[model samples]
Target: MTPLGVFFLSIGLAVLLGTARGSMRRLVLGGGLSLGVAFFAFPFSRALGFLSRDALDPTLLALVPVFPWLALVPVLGGLVWLLALRPQWAAWSGILGGGGLALLGLLAQAQPTQLVRLVPLYGLMEGVTAVGVGLGVFLLRPFQRGWWSLVLAVGLGGLAFSWLNTQGHLYLPKMVGYYKLLLPAPPGAEEKLVAEYNASLPEKNAVLKELGQPLLRPIASLRDLEGGLPQEAAEAGYRLLQPSQLQYGALAIFALSGLMLGGGLVLLRRPSLWEMGDPKAALILTGVLSTLLPAFEATEFKLQKLAKGWPFLVQFVDKAWPPNLANPEAGIFPLQSVLSEMLLTVEIALVGTFLAAVCAVPTSFLAARNLTRGSAPMRVVFAIMRAFYNVDRGVDTLILALVFVAAVGLGPFAGVLAMAIHSLADLGKLYSEAIENADRGPIEALEATGAAGVNVLRWAILPQVLPLFVSYTLYRFEINFRVSVVLGLVGAGGIGYFIKGAMDAGHYDQMIIGVIAIVVVVNLIDFASSWLRSRMV
Candidate 1:
């Protein structure tokens, strides 16, 4: 899209944001951040690369490449600190940093150009030393308690900014492939190639000398070469593996993502320091915008990129339309085959949900923080159970399905086991929360009646959270069915497996039949679940 079109579109987005946020302040903030990134931050940092190639002053230009970290880092630190932190020390930071840079520039100008250029890496050494002092001084957090955290934060923040600077490639997600394409030749390959090329030149050039053709020059560095090599050089193990491609876009990305990470950290910790008394919604939105802008840039998320996928979709539809419900295997009726696979899928979901609910019912009582409050041993159990839930939940159902498929050797049983394990953690966590929120009045009343602990739990707690548990189990059953379809694609045996077989065999017509069966069964299950929930849950 053109710049002017993008500008109008951004305005429309700002207006939409204003409507969503229900305020004018957030609209202005969103617009500023969006427009500023488009016009200022992105363009400015990209232009910084031109400084290395500037012909304005030969001496300054020469020094610029020598100490990239030194020339730009401190000025960037000062500006970020001033904008984000708003500490008492921020103003002095800017002044002292700027003054020091001015002094250094003056010294370099006054000194002999020959001496400055010949000097062995003073800029690099000084920059490294300063960074070291900044990082190391923060380790005494114990000895330096009160106001020292502020000082330590300053030291620690420098490390964060430096990390953000070097890790530019992480934030440039789209350009990673481009960078891999730019990967240079391995060490000493160029030198070896040069050696081989020079050794063969005498014999190769004799023919050229005889024909009065241009004699090939001896290869010194691969930089001197272009596309393709001479016949003799090709015979000698020469490779054009060293890529010379450069992208200046990375300079812009690093600068913006660095500020986003550093500034977000500071603002998250001390929102009062943000501009205009830290309007709560606006501050949160600002942080979100800061995070998402980088992500959008990283992922190459242009609307135009999305448009490129539509042609493939249109072609697939043209091929796949008018569903073919013919027997895939040796089945008498083709439609019954689809129904059979879908019923198998539902069975996997049913078994998974029932097993998970059974395990979760007993486990959740032990995990409830409220029930375990008085006993130290029970509290420990509670912590361990909650931790187990977290760890189990962290492993995705698809990953668990893969593991089970490996163990059980491909069937609906593997899908059932995977869904059960994943569902147990999710249900246990939900059931525990429901138990925690159960009415305390009934438990206290039952305890006062000289009831045993087990009796109190059976009568009082179960009655309160039983409805919620049923509701949660029903919901898990719904999710597990959807998950079972995915499991089939991994050879776990369901309608998804049938669909995958169709797709792999290039039977788009048969695949559409499976897809249609899946959609109809899913809707029927949802309707049944809703009616059951109304009557029972």
Candidate 2:
């Protein structure tokens, strides 16, 4: 076999080995991760190969010799197995798959206009597929209980939400015009905007200029303008009003049934369907919400020029809020300005995570029941730390920043503090878990050797769990990186605030640049964290 083929084989064997041993679970994880890194390293697999190529003739491309599918089948199967087993696999898959498929369809099979028209359909399909597959795996796995359900729920919700955004819809309520409602530019601001528009208006007699005037079309009603939905969503140009009706009806039925199911369960003194570990029921409920919310908030908008042969209803949705197909108007920040904002975001995340990690180790020991020997005083102290963790984790960093901005004011300082507090709580929990899970044999043996509590902990517990703790810290840092950006939206200072500001200013191009930068940074961080964790633990 060729070097690439041999590498792929080794990766597969390693992953299978890791998956087999409970103690060596991380090994399987590391193996899977190595395979991904290797795949990307291949020149043929790089985006440049797929994206830069404009080969129209298969015969000509064949002369260059792309690797046959047989060479990569093991890699493909490995990825598929990972997706079926790993929660995070779905997210990356959706991003790559959805983006690639849409791009391919646009470049090869359909016009830009047609591609836009199909955005919602593709997005829905992707969401459904990811959720179904993930939940199916969850059903097959017994250990995924307790907090695992919450993790799965969040993952699925996030996927569906991401899918919705990909379809050109922000997937928000109709009333939420902009992510945050604008108060008509403070009255005089509207007049100023109007005057500005009029001054820049193309001459009415200019035919080409007249055509461009209607580029964005007007929303026919408040409903039409709801959440910037593309208006031309009539199935293949077939106009259908209340496409959302089916969604609404499903929501209504589910909600009613959920209520009934809950009530019946209560009356009968039994668990509800969701309580019965019914992921399907939970997913149905999730889907119903996904569908119903947009329908109820559908808006009406009027487009002057027909961008595509969209059904009138589809067009209405499109005009209200630009769907994933047609780009949203860039906010104030242009593409050029995105880099600075993203850099700052990454900086804040790294600093904040490091700070949190430093503080968490000590607190975790104090909070661990095992280390505390279940002593009442110690338990009480631990209880207090636990309370702090709960409260810190419960409130999202964004909200904390809102409060912190009022107390400490803006800038990265506020963001850092917010992230630190949240991370402390998170890391504390993880540390405690590590302490709890450590092999008790060595710890007990140390105590039997007449070692003091402090010495036992220092000699036995710390060494065993330090690696796990480090891994968790790195993991949290990666999360904090993303969270800090999100918090920036609320003016906590990061890329998010800039992106949000750009969106408010209707600078679509700038918004796109900011968003693109964020995606790239987050994915990079995720990759790094995965690699680092694999090596450490």
Candidate 3:
């Protein structure tokens, strides 16, 4: 038969066998037969060139001729049949299968390559097969224990592994390079530096040779500046900032402050703080600390360095203050340009929040579990929507702004698009939770009165959730406004753009003005959002 014909025949047989009501012996025999057919059909289709090699791994392709000897299909079918006889075994088998598939995916991600593309398709095929077997067993015998905790543990483990692996491959090397760049040069380094620079470009060296003592002039200039005041101070600062030069008094103070902070974190009686009594929360905290502590140590978080730099920081502040409010070319405590950009930032936030709210309203209803509970298809739709929300929120707003800037060209419009997309995800999640927790009585009552779905949603769900939605939107507006200001650093056109320009040009006076404007605008928005949420609640 053709590959397409074989594919349909295998699926039809499996479905028929799966739906058949029979004794344990009959079901197992039928299931084994179906598995054998599907296994053989897969190889046959691949051999016929109907299934692309790109879509099927070589290992599977090689297994076609040896299908009868493989025995994997019949063995798995037998295991499922045996598990169907015991509820405990069936549930444990499902949990194990799911966890194993997830771990395989994680391992594949850690070593991603062209081959990794095949892993997902292979995993999906195996996962579907396992789930189908589990469901068939479940129909014959149900296992009712809580399996959610097992799933959560597997998921968290996979995520933690992926994060640590990524950090090792990406962040650790970058950090090493950064600190190496900051290292102090040894004495008589000018000759070595000149040699390296000359060696890097032979053409430049040849030109310099023709110019008689070509390298000597540049080397002399470097040597002459080697004993400068700035160099001396930098060398001195580097020495003073070393761990060996850390004062005992500073160490004592740091230890005492840490102790106090740790005590407060443990003893504080607040709703926001994690309860020490909760084992799960404690475990999560421990995991976080375990991951962060090594990173902090690697970065060498030194209190003594801050203390040594205090004098330089003070001198910088002294020079930066006393605003240049007179010069038109550079001066302006609050420049007209800065004020207008701040206003544009606010408008971007407002428009973005409005756009997000409009998009999220309908999407949130589709995502809410309680609303989508009655239908299996709707529940699947809900899962897909929630996954999209997670992906949208997982990406940073600044990164999103950079992407949009590339597509749409740099301006406030790029910032607006970034804010709107990110806020859509955030507000969709918040709105869905609110909708899911809305009073169900009104919905049921409306449905009893023969109200249409739209009418029921309008009369029952919206009234209960609208106030919270409005309040959350205002709160998000405050957040997006701050984000918009930062987005300006990437050419998204806000106060941050001016701030970045000032910093690049060493115009601290202008930069300070822009900073003050942002602070004032953010504070005003915070106050307004707080009052609005309070009144709405």
Candidate 4:
């Protein structure tokens, strides 16, 4: 009857399903039935005030009915319980339940003003589709059990989200029409009367307050409002104007979003490889189809028709361009400059690793029991070293960088010291493990040959532990490279500094290029380290 009651009843039924012998199948059916009803019915209930109540906190009340997808909490709670307590049901439940909640809440909030809110939902849908397509293509025996369940769970969830988004009525006054689909006005009816009703609403005052009076002025038509341009912009002396064509383009864009959204779902259900049951073809098809579908729905060409609509479509059209990578008249490659910054990052990592290795090896020997022996005095010494190692490691590299940066005033030196300190703790642990696992036979033989304590370690322990020590050092080196990049976030002089700078300037292309450079540099270091490890082995 009520939205809350309906949601609770659904949960009660789900619990009953969990008790059944074939629990997962029952859960699948029960969950679908409960969520399916609540998805559409809840919106209607909100409109009718079935769940409406006066608010204790007035500010929070504004966020409730306008965003009722909160019913998804129980669904998610059920899935998590199923995952941990009943692994068999986890695959389907986790994907489907998590996906449904995320999508339902997302689409319910999709007013013209809230379109940007769907970005993360779109991202989730993309992720779910990718995972489902991956599972369908790969038939690895070890992973098959978990993968199939995950795919089905995510698929069901995605479908629930898509269905709910399309079914709900737009909450913005009836005169504004739904955002995604434009309904035709009744024949011989005056559009002006509808516009007048829309102007009288509290929402118009709210919009004026948020957007400012000047921005809302000259909106004589729905086309003027949607397209964002006023007619006779020069004569009216308005700061911004949108052509009529752009308004239609905005409408087309929203319509295309719905189609693109639907096409992605259809692409997931179809099988591309019947012979081998390969899902790669299906996956590639989905990727190409979903990505390209929006391209055909271009709105930029309509910018010249500003009499009826907004110029927002021009923004999207500019995004479609490959980008003007040429220098801004300076004969300089901005990309190359960013790439050079990444080279400096590699330098910082290498230098820091070398310094850390030189310090960590001796400290590690102090922590190792083999070097100290089974004596109580030696154990106490080992304990102290271990305590010191953890303290050094426990504090994050960033804090260390901040501490050193404060002392030295922000540069690579602070970053290098931070990496060395963090590396000391990490390398100490690995070195101790290597010593613990070392062959005691060689150590015993040295003792039998009348070797002294230091001689035994030098002649027997060092030879056995050397390879392992090198491995740990190399691993720490890789970690150091990553740490150096992070350190650059605090002006430690690397690609991170450049990235932060680019982000601050709103230069996304430069930011992307910087990120690409960082990835390349890190990969190169990894490859070189692997080659070195091969030689060591």
Question: Against the true structure, whose TM-score is highest?
Answer: 1
Let me know the TM-score candidate 2 reaches against the reference structure.
0.43
CA-only RMSD, every prediction: 11.4, 22.6, 22.8, 17.6
TM-score of each: 0.61, 0.43, 0.51, 0.45
Error of 1 at 470 (Å): 0.5
lDDT of each model, Cα atoms only? 0.60, 0.51, 0.56, 0.53
Q: Positional deviation of 245 in candidate 4, in angstroms?
A: 43
**Using lDDT as the measure, what is the rank order of every candidate, best first?**
1, 3, 4, 2
Model 4 lDDT per residue over 1-537, tens place: 322333344444433433442223323323333333333212111111011121011111122233444445445544443442333443444345534543443343343321001001123333444455545545333345876766665665566445434542243132121211112223432244335535565655677788776334434444344432222221222211111112222222222222222222222232120122212332343344334434543534433467444555465345424433547686856577786778788788888888877877777777887777778898899999999988988899899999999989877888888887888788888888787888989989889989998898788888988988887788788888888888888978788887787668766666667777778877887898899988994
Q: 1-537, model 1: which lDDT tens digit per residue?
A: 322233334434434433443333322232224323332222211111112331111222223443343344334433533443343433333233323333343333233211111112223433444465555665545445746765775766666545544564477433322211111234675566668768888988999999999888876664455444444433332323211121222222232332333333333333333344323544565566556666776787778766988898888887788777665475535466678898999999999999999999999999999989888999999999999999999999999989988998899989999999999999999999999999899999999999999998899999889888988998899999999999999999999998898899877877888898888888988999888889987
Deviation in Å, model 1, residue 225 alpha carbon: 9.9
User: Model 3: per-residue lDDT, tens digit, 1-537?
Assistant: 322233234334433433442111222222323333323222211111112221221221233232223344335534543542342243333233222322322232232111011111223333333455545454444335436544544454455445434554364443221211112235644444446544555666678798885452334323232222122222332111111122222222122222222222222222122222333332343345345544554687778889999998897677657544447675544477788888998998999999999999999999999989889999999999999999999998999999999999989999999999999999999999999999989999999999999999999999999999999999899889888889999999988898898888877766777888888888898988898888887
Which window of ten consecutive residues has the lowest lDDT sum in model 2? 111-120
At residue 497, candidate 2 shows an lDDT of 87
**Which one wins on lDDT?**
1
What range of 10 consecutive residues in model 1 has the weakest lDDT sum?
Answer: 42-51
**After superposing candidate 2, which stretches have Cα over 4 Å from the reference?**
1-336
